[model samples]
Target: MKKILPLSATALAALIALSGCSTDTNGSSMPGMDHGSSAMSTAPPTNVGTETGADHNAADAMFAQSMLPHHSQAVEMSDIMLAKPGMDAKIVSLAKDIKAAQGPEITTMTNFLNSWGESTTMTGNHSMAGMLAGTDLDKLKASQGTEAAKMFLTQMTAHHEGALEMAKIEVSGGKNAEAVTLAKSIVSSQEAEIKAMTELLATL
Candidate 1:
């Protein structure tokens, strides 16, 4: 029979150490590879795809609804210039081409707007088609001879530029694929016309 003394603290510590306490060879606390290294060792988790939201639903529609009649106005102006007397053949030829190209487009886009249930007349409460400012149309109506040709070219060039600008806005901001395609086509065609007009302007 023996009286047992309470275990010393040093003896208990040694007993705990012997029960598999571990430390790095370099005296670091980590018993295995560091957390950062272990984390890096894992294969990167697969990424799930993300959803992209739609943009410019109404603005795209409005731009299309507005631009069709604007294009028609340009075609109409070209027709007027073509019919005017003493017009330069080069200019007249360009006017004819513009009218021919644009008239069909007017019909096409108009059909699109109609199908979309948009307003057709430009003079209503929600007028989108700018049917020419009154003064500008009056000036066009009064012009004749070389003056008419010059005026028409000048006006039409500006008009085409305006369309191109609208087109560019749609290209960058509008989400409708058909509208964007049409806008890019407008840019290409109008830029070519602009170059043609500039050359014609130099001659006059």
Candidate 2:
């Protein structure tokens, strides 16, 4: 003789069966019953488009031109430290990150300058804030081991601070939406790195 299962047991079995199959918004196979949030998943970037015309300004041009060389110098300083003996790992990592981020910004800024009919090369005194000088660079270069690492951290922290200042200026005075966006990004990313570097300096 065959026996029927209890109602609760039947319901549980039905739930399991339903969960085993699912469909997407387009009626495609959902597979594996992904009840979890797809919102958490990263999607490929879509064509959000770019800003044009009056959004750009002279301030944006200047910001890009000056920042290109400034960032280049920072990357240079970091490279120098990376090659030195007995360098701190934290500082070395910071240097590598700085090089990675700023080089791309330099290219973007140069492109902006070219598009805007402005000079890609740097101009004016870049001594805005936290910018290093001849003596400071020399000190960083000549130091050894932990001292060199410490100097690099200190100097780079200052450099990033300068970048933050410039970025703030761009946010306030820049006309181009894209330029301001990049400026804000600079402020956000560099400021975090500056804090990291500062904490690293304290440890050293």
Candidate 3:
């Protein structure tokens, strides 16, 4: 060797810094390294301000499951009235309105059940209130003119009353905020519809 030269301070510092930043087997820099972009890019997404599956209770689940079939029956009844000829204008309009309102409600309840990981179908053979029997539906299908309109109004009034009963239970016992809110809304709107149906029945 010609001459042994000591490394300068600047070059020594640079060497030490590079050695401190050695990467691990996974290619991520060692601890204490500035991992500005790479670290942030690999981070998992945050779920803040979102509704998760754990947000509902048993009452909420039951409300959704029960309302699905109830709303479906309302829609089916509306369809039956809509198909009948020579129906009163007011009755036809009411049937259309019932169809419009309850169809979306059915979809909303179904989604609530799905998100809560609950079955959409209600278990047990418990009969829902105000549901027309097969014979009642047959009589409705056979009637015409004012008779059909009267039957629809009478049947739908009872149906709305039954929905009000179920919704009141939800309003009192449901834990999910959205579900309770929907229950309250159903109470209000269906109450009004029931009143209107009562008035219509008087005329028919």
Q: If scored against the real structure, what TM-score would every candidate get? A: 0.65, 0.70, 0.75
Ranking by lDDT: 3, 2, 1
Candidate 2 overall lDDT versus native: 0.76
Residue-wise lDDT of candidate 1 within 1-204, one digit each (tens)?
Answer: 133334566666765553333223332333264465333333232121111113235656666777887887887788788778777899789988998888877887676556555565544455432357868888997888878878887888888877877778788888767767888888999899999998888788
Per-model tally of clashing residue pairs: 0, 2, 0
Q: Model 3 over residues 1-204: C-alpha lDDT tens digits?
A: 223234466667865665554433232553345465345433422232134556888889988888888889889899999999888999999999989998888888888887777899988886777788889889989989988998889889999989998999999999999999999999999999999999889876
Tell me the spans in candidate 1 whose CA falls farther than 4 Å from its real position: 1-56, 121-131
RMSD of each: 17.6, 15.4, 7.9
**What residue pairs clash in candidate 1, if any at all?**
none
Better model by lDDT: candidate 2 vs candidate 3: 3
lDDT of 1 at 135: 87
Q: Where is model 2 poorest over a 10-residue stretch in terms of lDDT?
A: 40-49
Across 4-99, the per-residue lDDT of candidate 2 in tens digits comes to: 557778878866655444322431333334444222221222111223334478789778877876898898898889888767677778888988
Clashes of 2: 2
Q: Which has the better lDDT: candidate 1, or candidate 3?
A: 3
Which segments of model 3 are wrong by more than 4 Å? 1-51
